[model samples]
Target: MKILQIINSLDTGGAEKLILETIPLFNKRNVQTDLAVLNGFDYPFLKILKKLNCCSIFSLGNKSVYNPFLIFKIRPLLKNYDIVHVHIFPSLYWVALAKMLSFSKVKLVYTEHSTSNNRRKRFIFKILDKFIYSFYSKIITISPEVDTNIKAHLKYNNDKFVLVQNGINLDTIKNEKPISKKELLPNLENDSYILTQVSSFRYPKDQKTVIKSLKKLNDNVVLVLIGDGPLRNECEVLVEELNLSKRVFFLGIRMDVINILKASDIIILSSHHEGLSLSSVEGMASEKPFIASDAPGLGDIVRNAGILFPINDDSSLAKEISKLLENSEHYQETVTKCLKRANDYSIDKTITKEINLYKSLLEK
Candidate 1:
């Protein structure tokens, strides 16, 4: 099964990272995998993909990919690969056009990675996603929340939406030395309670919420920020303004997130929305409890193991963080439950599901 995976850019977002992590876990078995990027830019993940020796391709994109010129290029490319898998924003829109225009007999699969609450957007997205999205042979969503949206949008073939709970490959971290815990998380004594977070430093993420929450906490606590984006400067200012400069460390665009999570005392997720937080999964797998912003998909992730505070509610977030800090037994219990829950979203489970879907589509 020759497969082509198309994404926007090889940035360090959860959806992009999941695709990078997934390529290695999949059994190639004469099934060659090709990766294509539309909005191409050189990113750190390219080196990682090369390290795995995976098939990687990038396009300057045809007049921004929404034009008819796209079909001339992408359609022919689709005919070369037996299966075409598309991810997130532009990929979903462009892949639908490519599949329909090609008239090529190949499987088209889309994995939805986010949730939307804007009711105004609901109609537009529903129409566009439902009409143009019909080219897909199968629809895969990382979170069940997306399934609900898919059902509402596409009245026909609603059953195509399958949930694949984003999974973590723990073996990648366990055997390796994990980038020397000190190097990734330096100058920290055992007495310090380290709180780690890994998310693209973007607006919806609101790392400021985490920073504001931490501002009210005691001096013994340290906050580690990972991933980089437009909001990094804004977050730095917030940390400085809150006088958390000494306590907060912004480790931008980290390649060793799992190592940082493994070394930290607990993980915290402040994302305003998530399909399935792979970061949260990594934290749970590392046997740590998490505090997350209460949002649709995120609420589902923190249901049993972590505490959920209202989105953008810094006061509530601070109160919950303080609660976890004060009660050792509560933290321990949450960690145990989180670890157990993380097992349910294992790479073994997700890989099996994804492969089966690929094979099923091939048979058709």
Candidate 2:
């Protein structure tokens, strides 16, 4: 089978990371995979993809999604593949046009990677989505919450939507050697509780609240903020303002997440919204006591395995962190449940479902 996965770019977001992870698994199944970027930029993940030696990556060389040139570039490309799987916004709209313009018979698939699309609530976009979404043969959502959110907008496209849980590759971190706290952050004392949040500094991700909560916790508690984005500078300013420069460490854009998660005492996801957080699952797979915000996508995943607090409540977050740090029994119970939850989202399960889906589509 030949499949082409298209997205905005090869950035370090959840959807981009999932595609990078999935393409290699497809190669192992004797399927050929390719990727096309609507708006091109050089990213660290491109190096990772080269090493994996799976997907043949291409770029349309357009800086903006609004560029009309994308249709011409994407149209001809679709003819070479049996399936074209698109992710993220703008790219979906572009491909919808390309599929029509090119007259390609290749099956089109889409995965709605967010719990909600903010534009869907607008009257104009609601009508536009109904037309654009008709191009796809299948539509996948990373979680049940994401599935429901998409259904609310594309009422007629409900039959095309499928719920596929985002999966983690357990074996990748299985034998990872954890870096010590002293190694991770210089001059950091022993016996410190590390509360880490692995997400880019973007909307819905409340890393500022995590930093604020650090002031409420004991002096020995340190907060680790991984990933970087536009809000990173603002988060850094807040850290300094709260006099938490020593207690909070910003490790920007890391590839050593497995080791980092392994070394941490606890994991937290303080997002205002999410679409089945892969970071939460990764932390859970590492057997850490995870805490997260009670938002749509995140709450759905962490309800059974991890602790959930009210959205943006730094004091509640602080109390939860303290409780986990103080009670060994509670921590141990959370660890056990986390491992079980992680198993449910294994890479094996996700790939099997995807392969079956592809086979079913081809048969039709």
Candidate 3:
């Protein structure tokens, strides 16, 4: 079967990472999977995927991802594939429009990656979303929270929605060699503990809470923020305003995230909500006490396996970190549980389910 995975520019995000990791496995299974990007910008993920050369890559245009012109650009490409799977916003809308405009019968599948978005907040957008979502043959939700939220927002009840939780390659993270503390934090003391949060600085992510919680922790604990976005500058200003410039490090986008996660003393994902964050799974698989906000998409995965702090509650987050630091046995036990939990969302299982879904769509 031929599958075309479409998205906006593959910058830094969970959906981008999912495409990067899964295309190769799909090809290995003898499925011809190709990728098409609406905005063919030279982002880090795009550069890395180009290097792998695992599948054919198509760039519709270098214009804005939301440009209405993308609909025309993508419409022609739809005829070449049996299934066109889309990810993220504008791309989702554009691909759906392309399918409608071209009258293409190719099955369209969209993966809803988050529990909430700005589009759902407005009445006009609710109308627009309902019309846009109707074009897809199947809609995949990366988490149960995502599934529930989108269903309620669209006010539709049908078998069109499928729950396929997001996953990561656990073994790759577990086996990755850690970057030494001295190299990761050159100025910090050798004995210092590092609290790392690997997420793009975005609206749904609560990096501010993580940064604020750093102030309540011991001086030896430092914060490392990875991945960059529009809110990154705001976060940097917060760190400075909080007089935490010395303790917080903004590492931007790094290709070697697994190594950094393995090296860190603790892994955290302070988000307002999530659709089963891959970083949460990666953190747990790192064998560190994975701490996250007790929000919808995140709480479901982290409650029994790792630590959950109140959403946007920095004080509670600091207390949780303190508890883990104060007791070695508890810390070790949490790590063991987290690593065991990570096993449930393996990429292998996700791939098998996805391939089966593709087959079923064709059979129908």
Candidate 2 lDDT (Cα, 0 to 1): 0.87
Better of 1 and 3 by lDDT: 3
lDDT of each: 0.77, 0.87, 0.92
lDDT of 2 by residue, 1-364 (tens): 8989999988788888888898898888888888998866777776688777777888898488678788898989988999998999889899989999888899999988898767877999988888999989999989988888888778864678888888878888677888887889877788788888899888988998888888888899998888989999999999888999988998998888889998999999899888878888888888789999999888878898889999989999999988888899999999999888888888788888888888899999
Report the Cα RMSD per candidate. 2.6, 1.3, 1.0
Candidate 3, lDDT over the whole model: 0.92
TM-score of each: 0.90, 0.97, 0.98
Lowest-lDDT window of 10 residues in candidate 1? Answer: 173-182
What order do candidates take by TM-score, descending?
A: 3, 2, 1
Q: Candidate 1: lDDT of 64?
A: 59
Best by TM-score: 3
Off by over 4 Å in 2: none
Q: Rate residue 190 of model 1 by lDDT.
A: 56
